[model samples]
Target: MRQTARPAHPHLLASPAFEELLGGGGGPATMSALRASERSWRLLVVRAVLDSAGSAPAGPLPPPADAWRLLARARTVAEEAVEELLAYPAVGVWAAHTLRRLRGTAEDEAPLWVHTGHLHAIAASAAVRAGLEFRTAVPVRRGWAVLPALGAMRVPEASEPSEWAVAEVVARADGVRVAGRGLAGPDWHPLTELRADGCTLLLDDSDPYRTLRTPAAAEPLDHAAEWQRLFGEAWEILCDTGTGVGSDTGTGTGSGTEEARALAAGLVSLVPRPRAERFRPHSASSGDAYGAALASVPDDGEQLASTLVHEFQHNKLSAFMHLFTLYADQGAARLYYAPWRDDPRPLGGLLQGVYAFFGVTGFWRRRGHHALGQFEFALWRSQTAYALRAIGGADGLTDLGERLVAELARRLEPLLDEPVGARARSAAELAAADHRATWRAHHLRPDPGAVRAHAEAWADGRPMPAAPSAFGLASDGSTIVPCAPARGFDTRAVLLRWLLADPAGFDGLRDDPGAVVSGARPEDVDLVTGRTAEALRAFRARVLGGDGDPETWVGLGLAARAEGDAAGEGLLARPHLAMAVHSELDGRADPLELGRALAVADGDSL
Candidate 1:
């Protein structure tokens, strides 16, 4: 008799399928498989957590093996319910955090048992979902016992308070009870789901492991209805089949419908972050959390749609990285300047950013005729292309990474040629250049010997020597550079946005720059609004008077370049060099004259 062939144990992407994902063309099936792979990885991590728990110092928490046994028993009762519990994003985050603690790579933020005891809660949830009769003890944190995918229950008052309390979970076909109280009562907060069309998102704000940050004081989500409506509209935008807002200049592939399907499959929930400034969108995704995107309230449906797409792209790529080693050890420590980030990023991080922004580009490309859409499309397309070039030339890519980068480049090439309006294009260029120069100023230092040599020439009344060939990465003895997030308001960028999105508003700011933009001077408004000559004069004064403002230095270069001053090119391209030479001169030289001399010294014809 012929035997039946066995299928692949865990789903693996074939070469063609992998290439399709790299080119940004994957749907629900693709996402499901990636999630399955992630689930397998989480299981392996869970196994590791169990294996290492025995060697550690014992604590008051329940045994890891007991929790694992309970989970295994629940799986036998109902595999689907067990899988759902394991697949909840918080489970992955918990497992990763616990594994790090077990291996001594992370801090013991909580008792090791508290970390290992989460498995018990997950098991209880699975048992409850499966309608199986079981009893297990779950950790009560802050008087609440959280069951993954279920909800949280407030543990009854104990005789004595401790850092952690063990609550008994009893499940049956009728219902589930925690610490002798039924979940049907008012003490339980069930995970809320926001459903639009066929897509469902858990608007999770209750789980303790919902975020990687230190647990904040949990407040009631008073804005749940607004979030539900916004999510509904955003889902509609991603699923709408209508022609997009602007003229179709893009040759890019894929539609909002496909994106919506894939996104719905890959994105399990949205965890609300702390409220941010009005109209500003903020979001983040972790590799450990495969299906959740932590996001702040967005200004509108369009903003929400783009933010979801941007973060889901990160989640998707993160899943792929779990399955494949894209780059080798040699490239792991090498940092490259990212156009969107102020700090230097490693090769892998650069790839993640390119992939994430590529999704953002596609989102705006569909609406590239609208004013804001045109500006965003132009901005991210240029930035992504710039970063891709860096990735293509960087060392230490495995065969897989090479193909992935090639596919990304191939898809981005046509988008680069797509038409954008003159104003948006100029703003994009200025924004890209500003960020590049600012990052270089903060993170890349010019050679001290070369800087000193050039400074000496200026002091001795000699022609400036040739500019140093290149700058070195600044670091404080660590392999990674020590850099902080970009400090202060980006006044020029804000003005440019206003100039593109709301021309009338931008014009209104011309008279008083500080009216809307904090920390903006009159020259800052003038620079972005085309009063380059006036702005150049103000910037020179600021720099000459010992104002080491990064924005001033960059703005000076932009204004000078617009006025056909070649001298500004050197300062713009090498703000770190300009700052160094200025420091060497002790701020005695005329900023413009120094820029002019440096321009000639760097071989730029003036």
Candidate 2:
């Protein structure tokens, strides 16, 4: 008897097949299932260029004529970089990274490179359009590079994804080759030093690089030793860590050098092909595997190992997503709170984040047992537990997503349930609560129509409904991102936290007054810090000066809410939560949270 399979959801049936399609997070690819993987992102350049040229973007500026020419040249170089990678064996990590770029709808806040994939397409396109020409020659260690420079024209940082359209270097029998026009060689009195491991780490602040991008440091790299040390360390750490996941680099393979070679080979084959493509995400000393192309390699070996695992997982998923259904169709686009990010993200972004961090949590979990000291062990264990539970908060997963999540949970069950010290537990709790609060604030949108009705009745002296149903979810999550990225979590909280500090820090605060209070009224700081009597005196002094600032408005609302004011509460809640959320890593909020509205705020803080 031939049994037919049960029907798929209507949305899934209606779902179009991926043809150079974007955004499954980093799932399986569609177009590359048949065509060469290299073509995916290059095609994306064509689509994006055409769309932008036709649409006339909303920004004040107009598109440059050279934009098309640059886009074309960048596409060619990006394809070549991919082709260079394809020389290795199977498993389309390059395709994975590239497709992720092609499909992602792109958060306006994200850098161009991250939005596109593998190559820094946006920057590269601009460079070519400006009449920049690149030469073809492999790079070597000993002598100065002979490549000629075009001029003093400033260029975008070649490290960012959409910004950079080609790898700085490609592998060859003699040495690693340097690519890109206006790329002055070392012998040509060049500020750009080409390293053998396939990167153009800036040696000095020359014309274009200085104007184009602000890298963390312009110090020269000790190319050979530095590269060897990082690779060896990363390889050794992976072999020692048990919980490491992914195909080539994730497993606990043989010796350090052996693992390093395999991992290096895989990276060169995929990910912008940089051993350390440091052109993107300039100043953050954290984690990143951009569109799964490049991994920001810091000096520390352990950090490098975890980074390798993290980015590699992105590489794997970016490809795997094309073949599988990890998230539901209808709800996949709904924004959710990702513990690691300050911003709200759709299902695909959320999944990529979770998957990447899963490797991090696992590295720490396993490292605790191997080479870690006592303090390190406890820290890693607690952090791992924090991430494990964080993963559970994700919604909109399909059956496959559930299975994957379940499997990861099973592996981490021991660590998740493991007992830890009080400090560790407190940190974890704070982290969990923080994320829950952020999610509530970002995802929830009160019923504007209902609120309007209640407000109108109040204004008209008409009867109002008793139930709070007037304030509920929005029909559409329109107000999710409401304002610009905050300069600080709360300009008010910044002052409060400072003032709340003991008398010992008073001198420091007084010395640097600008940062202490920021935009908040100093008197409001006093009131929040329990200097109420003084605050009252100060407030009265300036009470009739003029219309209040945004902070004053926020303050009035807060007092009203405390005294049981409904209209005031709704009116003020919007401003109260505006960039008011704090992160454990101070001065940093999740990028996903930027410009999004929040339904929740830590009220007590207010």
Candidate 3:
């Protein structure tokens, strides 16, 4: 007969911090559910690690026999962490400063780093209690390495040795023990430093990291010392909490590399962004509790620090979710419009996005006071507040989920009230607003009656009074339009999409059939492609009398303008034709601008 599995080790259950984390914000039933989840998680984590079998990333660590034993006995001090993920255990359910509903299913394969990071934490605490420094249960290999974390909150002096001994502490039910060589005096084995004051970028030649970022944009690092320095500086800035870099120093715990430092400081690992993810960051919906922080190189320390904190918060919540369900029914994965996103996300995705960004706002909150990055401050704070308001009490949350969300809102209250500048405020308002409009265009349908009424009113030459749209949206709150955008991220892309969606964009004005060019006017298209000023002016006159569409006229005018003119800029505020702007001058004049110029020059044609 098959044997039944025993409960998790008593050491873990005996820990108050663990009990409090799993049991907080819940009554007896909720706590009971959490306890069951905790036990499941413990078993699942161990089983998952074993399932990986002989993965390379885990190659150099202690033998599976020794490692598995220590892992089973490991104790966690995981009190719902926020803002920062000190080592692995202190990962907050959400950030300390970020408040919002979290959404997503508890159905992803937790990354290896999570189990390792958590175990690392337990081992670290054990060592400190024994009055000895701790090292990683992971050893250095060609592509993978983990170093000792900085002990305590004490800052190290410049001249002092920053390096520490490397160890891989394995655990058994009876006790925990350290395994690995190079445990003597200050050692540089875990990380190979490239530059002084550089965040030691541990060279991961391992297939997992290399393959994970194999895409051209996110291929493994160039292995330059300079690359290491840039990353190191980012860490140093985050460590400077005085500058508002969040509470963690981003140091201590495993090998002294920048990522390890962050992991030690309660962040997940730093994963390279694939080329496509250049503008934004991402985490698995299933939650990669191991903490994969995806980013490109850092040109701005503040932005980088904020990104680190933002993604870190996500990893924390991802882990938290592994222990409990934040929403009521996974089957009811209702999609909603989020203020800062382009596509519709499920309720779970919306919550996760907001939670991550709230922490990001906090990172900037601290820096904004000192750096005076008013715009960044304005944007993040306003956006976060809007998101919190939208999801704070919307629905689908369990009783436990409600309490946690309430606490998050309580923490967010102070952060949300801080002041912001006009430009930032405007952007904050615009982002959500744009998201709603775009969502309506994509997901909402105007009532047929309203549509017919609008048509008749327009034809009658007297428009109906402006009021809310009579859109037929679902009652599940999936159709809630975001309230926060004034503009879009890229007008060019927006215009392209608009043109594709609006049939009239190609058909031209009905009264002015000549408005849109059926085929590219030779001279106008030439003016844009050839950069000929003379051709542009002549081309403008050709389309001038024709009641050509706005796009046609804009193209002519764009080509006629003197060399070096800011193409399409005049259309920035044109609510009707706003989508045509391109990054590089589509050289030809925008027909709208060109047509207007002609109307001013000669009124007889009109």
Candidate 4:
């Protein structure tokens, strides 16, 4: 058998103030509270460390084992001091406040400095407890004292010092040569020594955290002009190749570079369009680029610029639909398609004229298919019909249906003609027939009164009657009526009917009792009868203090009620009609429905 993780010991270590608050108790009852207090302290320390490290010089630290040992020793000392304050509640509170203050000070500084700062704070406090005055000082080596402090306390370091000697490097000049090793994947690392010339290059074999910070190499012009030139060069490269090539292969060959440079120049000269933006390109090898948002033209600018314009047109059309109609939020108004990254060949240019025809039809439908409901489905059919007309009768009409009829017709048209073009014309004629059918369907009118009633019911909680009015009859000839239950006993009866009549509705109640309760109106008694009996059973369980088996029966009654069942049968079967009898005897049944249900059920049982 697998062993379960051991629960945290409350007395092993905790803030003195916390122990005092719980009256110095170390029992299981206080375990959760102790754990919460410990968590708060840990969060405070972590935040402090992160804050202090921000201003520290960027470089690899001493081995992790050495640092961890130093911190662990300091924690032991703090724990002892807290334990000593168990008898003095006021002192314990003061110590906790002081610990929080020290944490704040450490975090406000560099995060890397926190370990050293904490050691100093603890040592000073210990000295004060031992009746010796201690003064704070800035140690010459900054964070170096932490290691020696751990050593003095006989704490063993866990990590090898050599493993932490990572370095980072950067490029300096055009002609400088450098050899790198082991610097793969997504982190920055130090390169080999810089050449006599200004060139700086990345080293392949170095620690990942190691980095070199150098001034950006001097250009012939100002910073703004240099960035502009670079942006132009990048843009030209992208436009010419129609791809994002920089993420792989590093630098391209001479001709490719020249083409890229030219493209960039053109990009810079073109006026910045309203929607287009710029962004820096990054490589997978550098983790710094992982979540960084680089400037770039929006909408994944890999497609031809014209495609961007087309997408903008779709956005505008969607906005207009939202402004003009009620069902605008139903679904996507248009689908955007782009050639697969590895394949740039346009769909319109492939498969001879068939592909071009399909593209035109798809685009046209996207632009004008504004009919709602089944009419939208018809418009889709029309597109298929157009395709079939172009193909001619090559296939059969055996699979003709409201959907895909045009495609089926187009396939059939090819069989009627040797030339694909003649087949295409035949398919087009069949498609036009479907399109006409769709147009006629779009003009069919719905009952205006029903629509208005639905709209009102949705917007405002108006209680609609079961029977339709005269206006509804005139508009739709026949209106489907819904059941509407009255207040109190009648509503309870209706609920019982629904529970027996619709099992699916009861299933929903089982899945989510809260939803059922929320949907019930104030006049509805079925849910109240179920819920009240449940509350009473719970109260009884608390009063009698027995095992959970009786609570299970109460839960079953609640489940039945949520499913719209009459709780009368369940309550009558139970032994506790004594409370119900007493409630009825006191005449409390007059105002409260729950009291009334209990009185009636109990009286019948008696």
Candidate 5:
């Protein structure tokens, strides 16, 4: 086996490329750096396996040295094929997961060889692609030998699903065989690709490690044609017909084309996730898997287009992070709040949400001619802007992180002034305010002393106490605390979407909204559909009747604010404080009067 010398210098992103990534898109230079970073991780994993051969636990496969020799021989036959195999998304996932397990940094219960022996399967695939004659033992789980990007072979006669069995992979110039079964038979499953225009992607469904970072349940490929058709439609919306490639105009005929071009260049594989609730597309990406993403089928072409852009933005930032440190290591605390999520996020997670939504903002900005697009553009642009400011002012950011945040803010600030009609603007504001108020009420625990003082004073008919100086984000700071649903705020957001996209359909929901959406209430439908006066009465009634849902308080605040009431600002700004005081009164206080008192006591600083 022949070995090639590794590059002496570490991978780095040039200034221009880094700025391009910050501008909400990526290009060949950025993509190449990410791919190289993934390759480095793969090689690092292989080296770690070799070095730890002595202490690694026993399993069904050959020794680490023997497997390494087999992979080395394949590299000598076809260096490019071997590198490509190493850069495969699942390969990166396996490499990172295995390296963590091997170094004792991660607590994995599986035998060490179960992870290391994936090298043999990768080698076998490379040998087959190179047409090199070779034989090696690969792990078979659940009667299947998954060859990463190549495909999988069903070995029915192998060991039980709970245990790993070693299967012999013998390859020749003609074809490959697993356990004496030839590749020409039905037992061998080859991966398929979806092609449209100039964009091609591996529609990965069979890879064992294809689940990415989480253990996702796989669906049958019977609906493959439907997914392909939806993908083709999404491609039509995302295709770049402007400049040859990497050209994002941000306006007019070719706006978002550069982003589309970038998506095509960097996106290589997609794993189909189970269909999400409401048929909305769900997507996830990992820094370990640079070019790959997992997503459920989107409900429509517009959704598909945005979903792809969102996940690809995550991939771009992840890859960029792989090349450079963004923030110093954060201790174990998920303290920051992300507008898009209900739970408290860590600093790094907040940065990721900002970057991903930056891409989403760009997508809607380009499509702002329609009401749905305008509303989304208005909503996400504001949310993303706030998050950028939060992170920019945050401590622990490296010099590079500060620069990236500044560039992103510079690019996004202009969009804030872009007109999206008053109606769209109003709906966007309501939704954003609702989400913020609901998040605070759900996650931010009021200071107990302030709560008691305010409650006692209100009960005794004295002046209310001042707002709490600080609120605890979680009871336990070490891990992410699970949060209840966003009350009716999420339902209201959905109704707003329906109102913007399908008004007649939304009007039809006035009679019975719960018939359409399971948990949607009449007041929510009325609130989003412009019946503010009517909805205000209903929301006020709900709050006065001791309804403790945070959404009720937020809804009342939104309605009152729409009518320019000063008291509403207190509820919108400090719902956590209001809820604590309300609990002390046992829901007997008047909603507007309570809001007015809180606003007065807080000195209008709320």
Candidate 6:
């Protein structure tokens, strides 16, 4: 036991020291050992080459051929060491540490680390390729961590490891501030002084991407010192200003005035000088926490300032509309083409007509104007209606509603007119004619007597006599009246039966043309006509199935004196017209088999 201990293997001799350097680790220890072995082997190879090269020749006479051979062997050993070192565990730990440090830097600084690290590696590789022996024992000095926060030194370069140059550049800019030693570590740059109004430029020592505030909306800065000073001044002013509604009165006047002035100045600075006329603080709505514009009235000068710009657009548009329609009010010769002012129903009709026209013309298929119509309709039906209801009635406001409706119609009409094709005009005409015919037939043309009788019967809580049957003649032979046979019928069938059975009866009943129809009184007829006109329009389009001018039916029924209790006679005449049209369009009368199948499919007891 006292005898000299056997010498440790050459590999084991270095293992413990290498492990300690690598920090005790499974992969890292092994890697460090391999690197140690490679370095030792390379050293041995170099030693052997030198030994074989013999003593240096006096006066360096003739280059030794053996020196070249030894040099080649040394090069091979160096290459092998490099390959082994790349796979070393210590290298992996070093790389991981570097990456962690890079990521921990400010977001803007992180990119600099990446680029600089790449450049450093490239420089080292070039030096090694040039046969410059790198001292791996001496660690490369870590450059200043504060470079990125100072908004300087964007990229790493071999000659300039220090980021002082970048910091100096930003320090000289206006409205920027630099704190601490620019070459210091992470804590050197602080964002505590950053403020919206104070700083026109900011070094943004704080992590740009990590801020909870919206980065897109944030103003960017260029000079550190200038931005810092600006930010501080703005913040101080804002803090000193009064924001309360009554701050301008009495004891608060001084403070309030200063606050108002500061706020006004801040707002002015935000708007471009060219658009200053359009900028107004009072009209703009404040944004929500997420930076979206909201409809709520703003309490702060900043919010009000933004809102003014938006409201200005609306005011401008309203003025434009007023000017565009000035000609319409000039004289009696003025063409009163404003649909909404004349009739509420016309607005919808015009919109539908314009939309259909554009669709047929295939012009600007996705135009914003076309989509706006739907929005306008929804606004009228929902928001406008609710608003009107809240205001009780529009009794004193004679033309307000009408004017709004007309403006909407006018905006849509131009879109339709731009196409200028037969189909477009036809669609528009049909829409207008349909609206007018429906109004006239349902609200204006019914017999006064019939309307009065119906109302009286309703007042007395009694039903009017049953409507006459389709085939029945009046007791006086003066008229024929057709009643609805079923709750719903093929409109074509109903029309044909009525027309054939009562062709002459309606004409006979027209002697006292002004008289109201039986069962309905005069005033009652007028009210019913007005109330049900829109419904009648729909019924005419879908049931009667006529392509002819709807006015013809109105005139015929009124002029022929068929608008009394005998009004049923006029109703019957519609079916004949429908049938004739259908026959002409399809070249056949109702197909019995097809009708029967349809009835069965519809679950009808036909």
Tell me the tens digit of each residue's lDDT in model 6 across 114-191. Answer: 322322222222223334433211111223222111222222241275332221212221222222233234323332
Superposed by TM-score, candidate 2 places the C-alpha of residue 418 at a distance from the truth, in angstroms, of 1.7
* Model 2 C-alpha lDDT versus the unseen true structure: 0.37
**Candidate 3 deviant stretches above 4 angstroms:** 1-205, 209-219, 242-263, 274-286, 369-372, 460-606
Quantify all predictions' global Cα lDDT against the true fold.
0.74, 0.37, 0.39, 0.26, 0.73, 0.27
Tens digit per residue, CA lDDT, model 4, 1-606: 011343544333334322211111122222333333333333344334434434544333433233233333433545444222221111122223324444463122223333233333233323333333223321112212111111111111211332112211112232111112122322212222211121111111111111111101111111133234433343443334422111111111113333233222111111112223111121111111101111223323222222311221222222122222211121222111111111111222111122222322222222222211122123223443333342232222122111222433443233233222322333232223222221211221224454344334423544322222121111223322222212111222223323433446645555444345332332223233345455444533432342222222233333333344454223223212212222223422211222223223322211
Model 1 lDDT-worst window of ten: 242-251
Tens-place lDDT per residue, model 2, 473-524, is: 1222224543333332244333433432334553465544444445445565
TM-score of each: 0.89, 0.44, 0.49, 0.15, 0.90, 0.16
Better of 1 and 3 by TM-score: 1
lDDT of 3 by residue, 1-606 (tens): 011345344322224323323321112232233333433453454444444433424332443444434323332222222112222221221111011111122222323333333334333444433344333454222222332222111112311332221245533344434332233323222223333243333332221222122111112344445446655566665556422322222111112243323333343345443332222333232252233455555444455566666665565555567755777665545665465675566767777776666556655665554323554565556666656666666678776566555555555567666777554444343333333334443444334454444344434555332332121123312243334323333222222222323435523422332233323344433342244576556544654444333333334334433343433222211212212221012324344442232122111100
lDDT score for candidate 6 against the true structure: 0.27
Error of 2 at 40 (Å): 10
In candidate 1, residue 9 scores what lDDT? 85
The candidate maximizing lDDT is 1
Candidate 5: residue 393 Cα off by (Å): 1.3
Q: Worst ten-residue run, lDDT, model 2?
A: 278-287
Q: Which runs in model 1 stand beyond 4 Å of their true positions?
A: 1-11, 55-58, 155-163, 213-220, 241-251, 330-332, 468-481, 485-491, 502-522, 600-606
TM-score, candidate number 4: 0.15
- In terms of lDDT, model 5 sits at 0.73
- The TM-score that candidate 6 achieves is 0.16
Comparison by lDDT, 3 against 6, better one:
3
